[model samples]
Target: MFHIGYIRVPRSTWSVGRRFYSSEIQKKTIGFIGLGQMGYPMAQNLHKATKSTHRFIIYDNNAGATTKFTSSNSDTKAVSTPRDVAAESDIVFTMLPASAHVRAVYEGSDGVLEGVTPGVVCVDCSTIDVRTARDVAKNVEAKQAVMLDAPVSGGTPAAQNGTLTFMVGAPQSQFEGVKEFLQKMGKNVFYCGENGTGQAAKICNNMMLGICMVGASETFNLGLRLGLEPELLNKILNTSSGRSWSTDTYHLVPGLNPNVPASKDYEGGFGVSLMAKDLGLAVSAATEVKSSVMLGSAAEQMYKIIAGTEGYEKKDFSVVFRWLGGEKIGKGKGK
Candidate 1:
């Protein structure tokens, strides 16, 4: 039985319900897939913020995630595949890795498009590309569903604190319809433009992030060699206009900020694999447009080194600067 802000729908017609609860709050009952580091907390925050009238349905390739998510909410249940998530909800959110995975999840016979439960909206928060995001949206509209490329900024902590910023590529009216639901999961929201612009914004932002992290690491290491304490140097740089979100919140100055990934042995945050993937998307986009991405190119290559040599497990990207100093920094996955 699906409950939406006290409104009950017949089980058989739930497939087409326009998020009864959320539609009133301008919200929606969301189905989620890919419960990794970001997704797990994201889904949890969404569930807890809403009234009990809202419900959740989930699916993941990993059984452990299914178990953990189910354990968190007794009423929440797991499904077998991506299609199941799409079939059961008013809207679906996907936080997958790349375009390939996104395609397979929706284009495959057993994927989301199979039975999207008409009037349903599918939002892909995964940081994919402009072209892929647009194409995926076309497929969604053809099935009489809506799609938005609402990729986010601010990683795991934001996901947990519900402070993430969403750059949404969606129509104005459509975006308005889903914003209430999205607001429950995040604090900042912007409707960037049509279909793929949100993803475009994401790639450009990450291209900057890649360069900033690398710059912070290089400068910090160089300053340390020049007799400055890593922590003190980081503090000065951050306060003196050289700071970025990485330098402030992420604070690559390991052991200084006990809360960031750097202090936790580079575990429990955005995975290196995801960074590599985002940089790769940046590189590909740069190539397609023949844009002068001097810094992005170098960062993409650096990510390759980190991914291949250090393993794409879960290291904070700040570790790349340490890798530059030749100490063979941390790995995302255990070696």
Candidate 2:
């Protein structure tokens, strides 16, 4: 029950309260670019979460993707370029593929900077190099815009389920301002210092992930070769100190882990090509800082081998197990 100017009002039956709340809300405009595998679902969730008065403007290099997305989401307007999307929005989100792609969209002639207002907040969710991320942020700042490097984790499934984890790097003043949007698309959001640290965190995490996955795959192959059952070896690894996400959650061996990319013939998960790219970024960063990432460098080379194999590049990074087992590697070469 609530009192309004000496009148008692039952809160549960107060229709005016709902009207008062709705009238006080301000509508926001959101822009999204790069409608790829992960980006598509992420944009979908953001739209679903704030469809009331928040507007969503979108753009993608692929015309078909923009058309399909707008067709389904009537409230979303598809635009010509990234700049146009930014022009019509107050907050812009980009989920591009690589550093080069991110640079193009944010720094090109008709880029986000050209269209965004001075105070527009731009968030990049691409897994790119720290150098590129910082460069982009600097450019955004030059235009008096705030930029946040917010790379995400979890595979396509987590993306679709709106449970991805975001590692964000932004100014202290701007982190809280953009966190509400991040929360719409992610289950966890970690603010990791300034400018390019988000890319740093993501690359470092992926580097260790590649190392662990490769090590686990090799260990599993060795255990099987030494006459231990695959399931038994996996159980031992999961229980012992050798346990990691590679061993327990996303195990490489088929029939050992269900509903994983390994079980689906290495489809719809983090690809070998992407893992190799992240490893290369790690190696490059290590070299820049004179840091000796011995195991990380070796893991980069291993992923490179897997990426070079035809039909293996698009498969899950865990397919290193298949390569180790000598199944589908080394084609058209004299052995």
Candidate 3:
């Protein structure tokens, strides 16, 4: 919500709420170290946006990722190792699965440390722990490199469309420096402050989202089983105080929201393993902080149940609704 003095500005002015917008101040030799599911399209966006004269060097563990990039954009350079990418790049970006993986990629042989130049910037967009992010930042700093943990929001569609949101954790200088490259891959990029705040923000927000997903699914499932019409119920809930992202935007129960994966058959949006991994991170962080994450814990179990069933590899995290006996989901991946 944007407002000037006392008057509220029109709701239309709202873009993706990214704090801090100063243009590209730092010129860089852009690099991508991890190019997997979400990272693949994101790298492509960057490669397309950056001038051909300034090549975007990419490295991935998978030979297929390198082949795909080489095939699509012949000019984009494919490197054999993370070290090679690091040695050549002024700014290195990593999009990986977990904290341990991030650590391994950074500290292992031919890692970022072996090649990152002094004053080069390192941005890790993996959804990981605040502590681990800080630790990695410190490790990278020892190599005289600036590090930012800029995790993302919105799923693969957002990634492909460049509508993804970035929660960036870094000092002002480094955050502003990477804007040119980040803008190509994300619609909004926030400078949320020191080393791991971006990761913290993403985890906390996703934990709440996970819980909302369960609540929406359970309520709709009960309503449907009681012979209530899902569409009518959805219309009612969407407009009423019960409305939420899950209820209106990504409703898990069938017929509630046609735009969501559930309607098309739960498929690749944010993967189930990803959600379970996030929930696990949330619970682990919660225990460390001595916080009561009762709802997050319950949501984690629900995801576990869904993953344990036949639906594991086929569906999105939202399919936890059907696994709870809500409705038997449709076959095939969401298109």
Whose TM-score is greatest here? 1
lDDT of 2 by residue, 272-322 (tens): 888999999999999999999999999999889889998887898989988
Worst 10 residues of 1 by lDDT: 326-335
- Candidates 1 and 2 compared by TM-score, better number: 1
lDDT of each: 0.79, 0.83, 0.78
lDDT of 3 at 8: 36
Instruction: Write the candidate numbers in order of decreasing TM-score.
Output: 1, 2, 3
Candidate 2 stretches greater than 4 Å from native: 1-25, 326-335
| Candidate 1 segments whose C-alpha is farther than 4 A from its true place | 1-28, 310-314, 326-335
Residue range 182-275, candidate 1, lDDT tens digits: 7987999999999999999999999899888888888876676666666677779778989788888897766778998878767777766678
Cα lDDT, model 2, residue 157 = 77
Best by lDDT: 2
**What does the lDDT read for residue 42 in candidate 2?**
95
User: 274-302, model 3: which lDDT tens digit per residue?
Assistant: 88889888999999999999999999887
